[model samples]
Target: MADAQRRIAELLARCDLEEAQHRLGELVFDAARQAMPRNLPELAQLAGLRKVPEMFPGATPTARIQAAIDTLSLAGGGTLVLDGRILEVTDTIQLRAGVTIDGGWGGFRAAPGFRGESVVAMRRRRIDYDAAGYARATNLLNLVIDCNRQSGVGGLCHGNAQKDRVDGLRIRNCLADGWVVDGGYELFGQNFEVIAASRRDGGVAPAPGRRGLVVAASDCHFADGVLQHFPIGLHAPGAHNHFARLHAWSTYYAADPPLLIGFLDEGEGNTFMACSADSPRLADNAAPPGRENGGYGFRSGGNAINQRLIACTVQLSQYGDAASLPPPRTIIPVHCGQVRATILGLEVRDYGSAGFGPFVTTPSPAVMRETTILGGNVHEGLPTNLQLPWSEPGRFLPRLCIAGSDAGIVQARQFGAVTRIGGLAVFELSLCLGGLRAGRGAVTIQGLPDAAAAPDEGHRIGFQPVLSHWKGGEPVVAVLHGGGRELHLLRQSTGAPVTGADLTETTAISVAGQYFTDMPGDA
Candidate 1:
């Protein structure tokens, strides 16, 4: 066993990333098969998997499970079978490498005796990396985790100097609730399911930043999951992750603005493939409005850059019972700010109140510069301002916003889609679109007139422009405006706008976008 384990380690050290994940997945499954009671006739079966049985004196499932894990780790790693006996977790047991928690979903019960804070966690550690057959291998083959308590699995990465880096982790067939995960590198989550999520002790509304999953690790993958009943379905605060065939439904309400997939805080270079996030709130339990009131289907917050959503659909509505009515006047299915978003085969629909704002909206043309939208449908389900003249643009906002900026310029290309932008007087246009800072920066047609009509037309317009770039200043007012086009200078607060006699059209421009240099092709 020792020789074989060492050989596997050597193989891992040599194989490239994809090959390593494939090899380790097979190895862990093989180990699990070998450890099942069917192979060891001495052990009894529970819930169709080998049962480790309760330990003496301390018969709690947590204690027995820990003891079994310790035993398995000391003698190399193997599978730990669970019967789902409603274990109440007071402390989290860190999983070791090469250990697979097999088949817990079949018998796991919730709402009766489940009292765990967070069922388990596996941090990136040297022991995991160096252990001959420890958990750096694929762990948790079939776990049904219920954080009846308040905590997320894979809590913030544990590393020196707080560098969040993780590698060599795999969790599959996990059906969990509460806050699900904070992700890790080289991590693969397959066949995962979450029916609901919250920090609610019993009822809802007390959930604190609750979500089904939060991916904060790069090079990680999550595929084939149905997540529902959470404020935010998946929040990616880290970069370079991939998600496929993920469905989030039955949205809950939150003033923080619920989103199906949200990439925020400078998280860049992520991909969503064949992903769909929508509210079944219209269908679930007769559509009493089921919580997730008006909000964005997918939104990119400040600094979120270079993301691709391919073959993705985001359908949201603010429809709910009177108790669930949203306060906002409109809802946006997709909003992108300061992002080089590449959207292909995208579908966005808004069916309820909180009138549909935009299929994809960005406040600054410079923010979504280099954006490309190809082959998609943006439907508001009614005669919307999308049809009205730009004059009545206040009735409904643009389907796409490419308002330019200060630090740089804006660039966007639409292969096939209905997008609108109006009121082009913007010198450096930026709009604080909504209630939350996370969802602000809406460019309005009513704006830009201030810049176009400014008295000084030589220098950049402090008034809003189609260009919305930032130069490390608050209320960033610098304009990337230079063309034979006249420049408008000064703000309403500072002097008057002036026209330059020798202003030359800009032949060269610097860009601010960080990601999506190469657009994502297909799922």
Candidate 2:
């Protein structure tokens, strides 16, 4: 670049004024040739890229695209501009560094993309790594990558799972699938829809754990994408990710069970806002042979530590607990996570008319930061204790759910009602949502009621039992009002994991979907 600049100056000085102007124009053209391409097509030709169709016009589009990409990679890097036609390929095409496969040649969907076997792969195929530098900042913009083959195999785009083989890759405005962000760190993308992966048999029966996206790397952000029809929508197992306005639709496979919108294992400091998940079509989805159709909207644990789901909507279709399949299915089946998770302002609705799945199953050895379900409506009921939570009088007030089956009833023209907790009768309140396990004992109001006739019970009884240690702070104790009827919804507006209960009335919180919402599992 410096030599070219110097020569242009000397050439102009030696020419006459008219000749100088003409020659200077020529010099500018020569310099521009050495500069980088201003657009995608020019970039594709950087390394002597060729449109295989033009050279062999009757050849299959698959061969043309393969030859073009391979030739471009050999020539170094560039965008081999593809026409607006669907090409086909059999094997995974290596996406090279400084290469931009701009299917949208000019505007959006310009080239549309290839429909073939596998997808663009950033795998670590460049052996002697130290000798051959890895791919960097690869961009896939404005294209449709269709990897759905009739053969029922392949991924759309696969990243290196073992090492940081890619950095700063940006994928935007593309409709594609089989995304594995495992090996790439710092992938910034938005406005992309990942269609369901290659199904085992045209989706008649599900493939094991088919995924729309697996984000194992940290510091990744995705937005405005509809991830649908996979066993899991977003499989994130790292930290510091912000997901905004993502939709997970019909997550579970018909025969396969355990469908979830997203699963984060060992993931920390993540924020999920304005996300919605549902398994609407699973009403008659019987599991394959020995499998059961069960899953959650979202699940995190296994050192998943601190995360927040704010103002999200998790609407589960009607599902039932099957016979113990190796591990027993949780009764109040959704929203179960270990450790400190703070769920707030989420709309949870169960649309099952036959059998009822609980909004949140019992907390195992794990409890959310406070399990605050503030400012949301559960069409059926809030988190119910279908299984009684372990309790010690005056120490812990367990958050309970009303079983769907027990919601409406009539007995002697009287709807059962009570607002008190004393002796063994108080311990019996946890059983109301499932079956009335009425107890025999002398009952008294354990906590003072909101009364107009009596003096204020500023000394009203309440429990502040320690639930679990906060992810980045102290052990948090859930503050119960009355006899734990309402959860004091927590406000977690920042990236830090610290949460505080401020509001008074909240209903449902997320505990656990694609096929169903999922719990966090190992990568």
Candidate 3:
């Protein structure tokens, strides 16, 4: 028996000394007809799979899970399959390079409202990148990481600065967040839900500046995700990232000072496609005193440049009784602040009182220029004096070409020429008309500046009729009223008021002019 044991020991030691010891222990248990310990070391040798439950049997779940991870990592990196058990952790779980934790979705409880089968109930703990080491190819799959009102799993590339190029990271269905990606490249995340737990201090207001998913890294792609209950849902301070089919919902009533935006883009060269953001509801139909209370669906910060939104939607809801609510202050669907963007098929809807237009810009030191809205709908709850595609005087200039006809809004089919001189916007506007009666046609021209006064009695600007493709005589003169907000075609060649008989379904008109705008620049 001694010789047999020595041979077994020498043979096992040839593989690995520590592994040999675990094997020997298992052999002894098997020989004694007793069940072998189902510890991590033994199970790893037996099943070639590292599991959390097979760690130190008497240790806490956190320690056991960490031990299992460490053991798998020490074996040159592998997957740590989590058992369908709730592991309560009080400390952050540090992930090493090349390690993947896959808590199979099927392993967790399937009852409604169940977070997941493999749940990591974090009592202020999080799963983060290893501090002492650089992690590459680390992933979390099908795991529910509950923050319990503390921090959630993320910051994978934290403390490494932006110099490290951590790659091949993937997170799926983690149901975790406060997730910060400060440094990383090529991350592919899908179907992940980020929920900012309620504040522990029992305060109704959101923790000051609390954000759900803060991405400060570049070249990452996220899709089909939901970020809810955060002051700012998806704050992208990174560049060259793509977010597709993501929904951002903010319920925090307290204003976050300058703005409470669902999706705030301070990054450059990012593309949001088919994404939607639901603005936050006002608290008790009232905002804090001396503070503006309202939500913005999407905001492009002053530093944001070259951003693109394709077929995205933003909706602002009016909570409680609209009549009782204070005068709507800053409720805007999309606010473009000193940035260059190209928006296509963007739908902005407001369900509250009259507020800012669908797409608007406030006065800023830096100019908001080169913004192009290709196609979209701005559906407002109430008739507002603020014009569609509105911009404040002085530095807001956006080129808008609204295609397709909607009943209430002006749809400009195309723009012939748009140029700005000093603070004045000079352009030739064109509209395709199916049917027009020339007695007195009020045409809504896209890409026009807002009027300082009400549309009822606005500054009228004269425009020369460039050309028209109507069978009847074209209007010899055109007048743009309300600071170019409304265009009225008048005076036929025969000096007669052009009647509906002069126009046909295929008629098209073009007008050229330059108007003095309230914008500050060389007039």
Candidate 4:
């Protein structure tokens, strides 16, 4: 009721009351016809469309739609084309086996090549087909799945417990995700696919375990879209899957890592094109990754097994004392794998403990691939390095951290100890900032060179700061490298893991802060 009232108010505020009332009348009339058979005959009277087709001269499109639904309910395998501007189901209607539902494309308004409508406004869908039935549809635009009054769980899109395939659809702005996967014990779908889709701005997270496009199978593709504030965006647990050209941000925790593939699988061909990682914390907690403050980029702690990550980008926002984390310090606790990573055109800065090296890997053995750490930035902490109490053979490619203000390029060893680094390159001395403080937590980067000779040494990299501070004295020339990239900033004491609540709080603060300035997660 609140939502309806809100929409009504929005219309009234944006449009003339007379026009709003007319649209509302049409919606009510459409709803009546679908729920009441006696009302079906009157659908034509309300819409002014003839009941008889000019050729058939017998029944209208509205009648045909009803006839199809009714006949299919009996004949079993029929296609229903619904043309009324509004089709509301006040009651539950089970669509039996091999049925197809065809709704208006409004001239491809809700699809690609045409940006007609992004929102699908329709009424409830208790429309049941056998959980194991096979059904298909295309172009479900501005269809509202209002279950607020009908079912306790109000959602925009709903499906059967078993196998179902929905393709070439665009569903936007509803009570929830454009398409929803219902929760039931039944194990459905031997194979299901949703290709070329888009979902944007819906209500807040739909309960505890839901997402923009939630699936539980072996094959699913959620390609292309601008999804925001969707709690669990693009969540799929089935293995042997592929995710390409998918962009997501401001989601509490996206693409549940291990579940997307398997705990022991590889993520080689997957590409997270220009995605942003923001604070996930919503409230306060004492744990490092708690909801205590509710600001976070991701909560990918599940399957930390053998997984290969390639061609992905991550950008994080920081605040307060944590604003000075070092390079590589920002990307930490990497699991075990013969992972081939290339860090081209990357930026890491602003946090207390910038980077923590090679987190504890799984018992399974893994190798480091040709990791190119070039054209990047780092801040605050030491060239943080950390090695597993039990691990070996750490390697990289095009090994380099550019020199610049707020770019901390530390030797891998200083952060932690590792068996070996394949290619090491420090283009120039990056300008780094501060380190962690007391009570938060602490990290230690060991094995980096304390000092080096010109050109070859860590200090002689390039772009020495006009001023710097080490212990209580004057600043010195923090040597830069060959290329004018990377910053050699002051290091601080290591801090503990961040608490979840703190993250949330920080993120909220940042968001609120952005409204006053520039939005934080715009890209």
lDDT of 2 by residue, 62-121 (tens): 444455454445445555444433344555566655455665422111122433434566
- Scored by lDDT, the top model is 3
TM-score of each: 0.55, 0.54, 0.61, 0.41
Model 3 bad stretches (over 4 Å): 1-59, 105-135, 151-177, 198-205, 252-259, 280-294, 318-330, 351-356, 360-369, 378-407, 411-473, 476-489, 492-523
> Superposing every Cα of model 4 onto the true structure, what RMSD results?
18.3
The C-alpha RMSD in Å for every predicted model, in order, reads: 16.3, 15.1, 9.5, 18.3
**Sorted on lDDT, highest at the top, how do the candidates line up?**
3, 1, 2, 4
Candidate 2's TM-score reads 0.54
* lDDT, model 2, position 45: 38
Q: Stretches of candidate 4 above 4 Å error? A: 1-70, 73-78, 88-97, 105-178, 182-210, 251-286, 290-310, 316-523
The alpha-carbon deviation from the true structure for residue 523 of candidate 3, after best TM-score superposition, in angstroms, is 16
Candidate 4, residue 337: the lDDT equals 35
Tens-digit per-residue lDDT, 1-523, candidate 1: 3343344455545644344333332333231222232122112112122222234652444454565554455444556665433344445655655456664452232233334434565554565554343334645555554443232332112111122212212221222323344545556666766545332333333243456667666776778876666556677777777888888765344422234233222368778898877742221222222123425566676446888888887655564344443333244445665457777777655565443434466655455455666565434342221111122222222212222221111112211111123433222222321111111232212222222323333344333332223321222223323231222222335433322111112211111111111122223
State the lDDT at 227 in candidate 3: 76
Between candidates 3 and 4, name the one with more favorable TM-score: 3
lDDT by residue (tens digit), candidate 4, 235-346? 4433334444344444223321101111112232222333333322222223232212222332222331223233333333343223222233323322333344333333
In order, candidate lDDTs are: 0.42, 0.42, 0.51, 0.30
lDDT of 1 at 382: 26
- Window of ten residues with lowest summed lDDT in model 1: 508-517
- Which ten residues in a row are the worst by lDDT in model 4? 508-517
